[model samples]
Target: MRHLRSLLFVPGDRPERFAKAAASGADAIILDLEDSVVPARKADARKAVADWLASERDVPAIVRVNPLGSDQIDADIACLRRIAPDAIMLPKAEGAESIATLDSLLGDLDAPIIPIATETPAAIFELGSYRACADRLAGLSWGAEDLPAAIGAATSREEDGRYTAPYELVRSLTLFAAHAAAVPAIDTVFPAIRDESGLAAYVARAARDGFTAMLAIHPAQVAVINAGFTPGAGEIARAQAIIAAFADNPGAGALALDGKMIDRPHLIQAQHVLARAAASLLPSEGGAFSKAFNRSKPHTTSSR
Candidate 1:
């Protein structure tokens, strides 16, 4: 899970902002080329991404390209070879065949793929196939804007500040699809950059609904998003207690601990909390407390 609690989206056309974005406290950054860039600025965006990939990108950079069969696909590939990013974001992926084509094209290249299970109605039906991408497939995310428009919806949001019924179906399905395929389910960006409290609420809702991460359109949202997903110090302490108690009784599936009946499921949940803490310890752009969750050094040999 690599503590990708907050994935920030930076417009590919803004080359000057790229480095600043990389330096932001976000765990990973996506350089967006699809919706964010204007049609006339496509070339300029592509050139900027190519240059950044080649030299300037400092963090775990993901370059998102146009759809699979689009005119700019080849150009996207060329930039990939030049810049060599941690992953590539594929838009409008309908099923396994599209991923297979990307895998075949990459052939032996090591860059992973992050698919946006969004856009058209057909994509929603075949979303589960994205998990077959495996190691080269980093995560699964969705976009409400395109999908809602494709389905002829007035807006993705409802009066209660929630996704409309159709979009909600897609959102939940994408989460299930990601889980079924054994990958991280990343929630889409919240468009309201100025609403910090609203952003936190949305991210909290997403986390509760099984999303491991959420995309941030602005750096100001990063702290709130990260905070929303991460287990606080108090939670970490509780998880640690459960783990220690479980370790003390290896053969016991259930035990009474601190007045609660802690069982195997509790232990499993505790381990997940600890694992998340460990990943948060990576060289993230955030502060020291960010690494406080990462207890990786004491036992480096053990897999996270």
Candidate 2:
């Protein structure tokens, strides 16, 4: 579908919160069956999520199933077979092979996939391989929490909440890999839910670093994420001016706009800004997103 500026996660077991999350101003809601739910509750969560998805809903629903090869995955897939979500969020995804594997398990289900691409150590090296299965992807996102635990690190970030060097490397790799695969680069969740100022700064950095959207842990963070990703009045005005200047000189490679030299690259950037602005204005209902998912098919390619 269009770029999701914010995707709020709601625990699959907590069905009571599903409707609240759908109305939390987020572009979509991720029914988390992975990290959020306890092992004892996975089956119940799957049933709850299936029941919810089986009914009609206004917002798009993306179910975050347990990681591949886990005992819970078979049941997760079975639940999906009963009632398909708008998309599947595959956690601990390693690359094209991971996507291909999930696609096989999904069978005829036509939901799109969004992989959390950098959760394991081996996944770091597999980032570039996503290009092989980009057509099956909705976007690519990275997580810092699991990586640090996987590597036995004390923490993934510094005292200031900035990511350490290794985590930074993975983050940048995930960003470039998404672009290389021609998919949206989705930033990871900001864990400090109460730190609104910090969240704003993180969102600003994500937008500046070319992230099309961000994950949200709390409903309070949705509005901030949406506002951060949407173009401001000044930004929209500049983008419009750039487009007008390019239009005025159809065959020119470069032109002066408001006393500054603007080139083809500038025009392309302006177009992207306008596109994001327009996407932000679209209705949050699931009609458009469901149609987009139905139209999507797994890209046929040999597993890596």
Q: Name the best candidate (by TM-score).
A: 2
lDDT of 2 by residue, 230-280 (tens): 999999999999999888889999999888898999999999999999988
Cα lDDT, all candidates: 0.77, 0.91
lDDT of 1 by residue, 9-100 (tens): 89999999987787778888888888898888888998888887777434677778888888888877777777766777889977666677
Q: Return the clash pairs for model 2, or none.
A: none
Candidate 2, residue 201: lDDT: 98
Would you list the clashing residue pairs of candidate 1?
277-293
TM-score of each: 0.88, 0.96
